[model samples]
Target: MAKPKSGAKKATPVGKTGAKPAAKKDKSSRLDLIKNASKRVATTTTKVVKAAGDAPAKGSKSAAKKAAPEAEQPKEKVSEKTAEKASTKKSAAKAAPAAKTATAKTAPAAKAATGAKASSGKSGSKAAAAPAVPAVEKPRPRATKLPPPGEPLTKREMEQLLTAGEGRGVMGEGSLKGRLVVLNEMPNLVVVGRDKRELTFLLQGPDQEVLPAYVNHKVSVSGMIRKTTNHGGVVDVRKYSAKKPEAEVVEAPPADTEPRLRYLSPGEVSMVTAAGMGAGIKGFAAVRGNLEMTGEEFVLVVSNGGTRQQVSFIIDGKAAAKGLRKNVGHTLQVMGVVDKTSGWGGRISAENVEPRPSEARAVSRDEMELVHIEGEVPTSVDVKLNHGLTVRLPEQPGFTWAIEPTVAKRVGLREANFEPGPNGGPATREFFFTPRNPGTFEVEFFLAKALAPGLVDRSFKINVTVKP
Candidate 1:
C-alpha cells in the first residue's frame, strides 16, 4: 500500500474492505458533525450569554439550567475546546443570576426615586391650584367736599347723596329751629321737644362764626345739613336768625260791675264762725261803713247812721292796700264782691273804697281807748270805763268763747273778730269788751261747742278791775 494521506482513511483488505469502507465513511461523517457543532457552539454560547443577560430575574435560574446541558454536550465532544467554552458558558450562567439580582436590587431604588419625583410633582401641582390669600383694605374717611354756594340742592341730588351715604354722612338742604349753644368747643344747635326728645347738630358754614352771639337764643336756620354720625350731624347754615324770649304779660282781674252775692247756709255759717272772722264768703255786696284797721286786717263797721243794726265787715288785704288804709277812721262807701257772709258779719274783697259824707261820726282806732292783749295774760286785768279791751285767743274748731251772764252785763262783749294765722297756721279769735261801771269782778271765759255748751274744751278766769 502506498502511504495514506493524513486526512483520508487507509485502504481496507479485500474481504473486510466493505466493512472498513463503511466504518471509514461513518467516522468521516462524525468528524464533519463535530466540526459543524464546534462552530455552532461558539454562536450558541454567544446567544445563550445574550439571552441570560436579557432574561427576567424570575426566569434566570431556568435559563441557566438549559444552557448547562448545552455546554455539557459540547464538553463531551471536544473536551479542550468545549471545556473552555463550557467554563465560559457556566460563568455566564452564574453571572446571569448575579446580574439579575443586581438589577432587582437597583430596580426598587429607581422606583423609589421615580415615586419621590412623582410625589414632588403632585405637591407642586397642589400648590399651583390653591387660591391666594387676599390683602385687607383699610377704611377711608368720607369726603367732606361741599357744594358751591347757590340755590339749595335739588331733590334728586339730595336723594342720591343720602342713598350713597346711608351708613356714613351726606349733605343736603333743610331747615332747623333750635337753641344755639357751644358744646365741646364747637357750635351746635340743640332742639328740645315734648316728651324729652332732643336732637343736636354741629354747626358749620359762615353763619357759624356768629354762633357764640346767639347762645341761649332761639335760632332758625336753613341750609345744607351733613350727618357725620348716627346720633348727630352738621349744619352748613346759609341763612339764620336768632330771637330773644319775650316777657310774659299778666292781665288784672276785670273790675267792671260788682259780682253777684250768694248767701251762706246755716251749716256754712257755723263752720265759718268756728274758724273765726276773716273766713272767705261766696258773695259780693256794697256797703258804707267806717274803715278801721285792727293791726292784722281792715274792718268796716257799718252803723247805718245808728238806726240800723251795726255789722262788721272784714276787708280783703289786697283791697285795703289800694288806698283804703288812707281813710281809716272816715265813713267810706265800699263796693266789691263778698267772699264770706253771716247773720252777724262777713268778709269783703273790695274792688273800690271811697270816702262818703255821713252824719254819723266814725270812731278811729287811734282815738279809741283800746287795750290789746295776746297769748298769755295776767291773772288780774285793769280796764277804764267806756274803753275797749281786746283779748286774742287761739281759735279752736267746733268751739266758741263765752263769758258768764253776770260778768257780761258789767263788761259787755263789743264784738268778736277772727284773725287768720300767718302762713296758713292756726287762727285766733279777738274778743272786745267795754266795762259799764267801776268794779272788781271775776270774769270767766269758756271755750265750748255751740250745741253743747256744757262740754268745755278750755276755760280761763281773770279778776278784772274797772276804773273811772
Candidate 2:
C-alpha cells in the first residue's frame, strides 16, 4: 500500500538552510572522567568531610593527660599550607629516585627536622632557607645563539650544547655557523645549514662557544654538500663568522591599481560561501556582498527605494573572503577576487565589487501572507492570527477589498496595501473579505516572496464556528 502523504507543512527556508541536523557536541575526555567520578560519588558517597569552622588543622590537645602511662608526647609534624610546598620535596625525590626509594629512606631525618622546627617555632628560619633552595629552573627549549653575534650565548643554551656534544661523542668538532636550524632537542646537537647539510656534533664543556647563530647575520663557509629528496638540499655549515646583510626594497601592487575595500561603516555582509563568488580579480575589488555567487549563476540583490529589490548575481571569477557578516547588516563596498569556499564549486566568480551608496541603507523586512482562515467573520469583528499576531488584509500592499461575501451585512475598511506605480508614482490596493460560510475556510496568498527576514505566519481566524 502507498504511504499516506505527510500533511505536515513544508518548512520555509532561511539563508538557504534546510532543517539542519541537530548538532551533536563531542563529550570532553577530561569532563567525562570528572562526570563519571561525580556520578559514582553521588550514588555511593563515602565519608563526608563536613567543613568545620576555619581554624588551624588538627587542633592541639593539652599535652595528652598522663593516664595509664601517657604515650611520650608525640612530636608534631610541620604543616604545608599550600600545594607548592610539596613540589620542592617531590622534585628532589624524583631527581634521585635510587636514593630516596620510599618515605622510609628519609623518614628519620624528616621527623627530626619536623620536631626541631616545631620546638623552635622559628618560622622565619624556614622561610629564609626556602630562598636558598636552588630553584632548579626547568630547562627551557630556547633556540640558542641568536643575535648580531657579539653578545655571548644564554646560560641554559650553553648547557644544552655541551649535553648535546656528550651525546654526539664529537664535542669540539661540531662548529655551528651559516643558516643554523635546530633538529632535535635532546641527546646531541643535530642541525642543518641554509643549504640543507646535516651536522651532528656534541658539546664537550658547558659553554656558549658551541651554539649556532641566525638572524640578519651572514657567514662564509666551505663544507661537504649534502642533499635529500624529501627534505631539500644544504651544505655542512662549518667555520664562519657573523656579518651584516644589505637592504633592498620590496615590490607591490600599483598605487592606483591597488584598490582597497572601505566598508562605509563598521558592519559586515555575509553571503553563503557557495554563493559562487570567491576572490574577485587579482587587481580590482571584490563583488558587492549582495551578489550571490553559486555553482550555477550569481544572483544580485537590487532594491528600488520604495518597493524594488537588490538580488544576488554571479560573475565569473573568485570572490573575496567578505560578505554580509551580520544577518541584517548591509554591504558597503567590495574588492579583489572573492575566494570560492571549500566544497563549493569554483564556477561562479566575482571580478570586482563596490557597494553602491544606495546600498548603504539595507533593511530586513518581514513578508507575511495568509494561507487559511478558520471560523467565520461576523459583521464588525476582528480576527486574531494563529501566532497571536494581529494582522488585517488592508495592512499589506497590492491587495485590498478583493473578497465579497453574501451573508455579511457590512465590511470595514481599516487598512490598505499600496506599492509604487510602474509610472514612477504611488500605487494602492484594497481587500475586503466577508464570509457567509459560517464555518472554516482558509485565505491564502497568490504568490510567495524570496527574500530576507522571511514572513512568519500562523493562520488567521474569527471564532464564529466553535461553540462559545
Candidate 3:
C-alpha cells in the first residue's frame, strides 16, 4: 500500500489482535430486532393484562418481570433507537394492572344488567301461561211491610208479628179480666176465657204495691198492654178494680134418699152419763187422745180441761191392734160403746180408730167470748163462765209459767201457745183458760225452771170472778 492519506487509519493484523473486532451491527437489522422484541413485549403485556383480570393481583408484577427479560435481551445488541423502543414496551407492561383494575370494577354492573333482563323475560312467560277466573253474584234480601194499626191481623200476619219483633214488644190498649195471683214472689194475672184458655200477664204499674192485697181475687184492669209472648204479656194498669168471687151453691139431696147415722148431742151424752148405768153404758162416745201401750192393753191418755184421764181400748181383731200400734204417740179418735164394768174407770170397745186431723184443733175466735188480762190485777175481773180468758206476756228463755194447783183446778188451762215476734224480735207466750166453776179466786203464775220451781225469775197474780 502506498502511503495512507492523512485521515486514513491503518488496519491491524488478525493474528496480532487475537480476534477480529466484532462486526459492527447493521442499524436496520438492529432496528428490526428491537421492533420484534417490542412486538413480543406488547403481546406478553396484553396476555398479562388478560391474566391479571382472571388471576390474582399479585401475579401482575411477575408478568411484568417476564416481559422485562424479553425487552432487555435486545438492549445488548441494539443501538440507542432500540433502547428507546424497549423502554416504551416496559412502560406498557407496567400499565397492564391498571387496565385490569378498570375491567374488574365494571364487571358486577354488567352482570346485574343481564340478570334483570332474564328475570323480566321469565316473568312475562309465566304470566302468559296462567288461566283467568270469573266472579260470582250475591242475592239480596226483601223488605217487609206492616199492616195498619186499626185493621185486624190475619193469622199469617199474627205469626209474622210474633216472630219478627223480639225484645221489642207489640203495644195495644184493651181491658182484661182475670184472677190476680202471686207467682215467683211477683204479681201475675191468670185469665180463663169462654174457651177455657188461660193467659197470664205480668203486672207492672204503680198499682203493683196494692196487687198483693188482691191476690186470689177477680180483677179487672185496663191500660197499655204489651204482648211479650203468645200466652203472656205485661200490663201497665191505668185503672183497676178487684172483686170477691161469688160462692158456689150446692143443692141438698132429697130427705128420703137415705137415713144417715147421727152422732150423740152434748145434752144427750150428759143425760146418759147422769142416769148411772153401772154395769155397761149402752151409748157411743168419741174420745180423742194420744195412744199408749200399758201392760197388754192400748190406753188412750186424754187431756180434758187440764185433767189427764186414761181410757183403755178393747181392740176387736189383730188387724185393729196392728193399726192402733202404728198410731202410738199420735193423737187418735176412738168411737165405741162405753163399758163401765171396771167401776169409775171405763173401757171403750172400739168400733173404729182413726187419726185426728191435727194434734189440737184451732178454736174459732167468733165461737167464744174472749177476756184478755195482762200484768197484775188487784180487783176481781168479771168473766162469763165457759168463756175463754187469755193471759199474754213476754217470754223468757229456759223458764216456764207455773200456776198454783188449787187455782188451776178451778180455772182450767185450755192451751198454752207461743206467738213468734215479727221481724226477728222478742217472742210472747199465751195461756188460754176457761173457768170450770163460778167463783172468785186468785190465780198466781210464776216464771221459773221446771226442774227447780222455787227459783223464780218473775211472778204475776190476777183475781177473776166467773158468772154463770
lDDT agreement with native, every candidate: 0.60, 0.31, 0.58
Model 1 agreement with the true structure over 207-254: per-residue lDDT tens digits: 555677878889987777765754457777778889985676997767
Q: Tell me the lDDT of model 2 at 272.
A: 27
For each candidate, what TM-score against the reference? Answer: 0.25, 0.18, 0.24
TM-score of 3: 0.24
Q: Write candidate 3's Cα lDDT for 54-127 as tens digits.
A: 44334544554464465445434344454455534554444344444533443443334444554666687788
- Worst lDDT 10-window in candidate 3: 303-312
Better of 2 and 3 by TM-score: 3
Best by lDDT: 1
Q: Return the lDDT, model 1, position 12.
A: 62
Q: Model 1 off-target regions past 4 Å? A: 1-284, 290-320, 328-331, 339-341, 356-375, 381-409, 412-434, 437-440, 444-460, 465-468
lDDT of 3 at 344: 20
- Evaluated at residue 412, the lDDT of candidate 1 is 69
Q: On residues 113-227, what C-alpha lDDT tens digit does candidate 2 reach at each position? A: 4445454555666677776666686875543332222223344433343232222211222234443334443222335532234444321122223434433344443332222
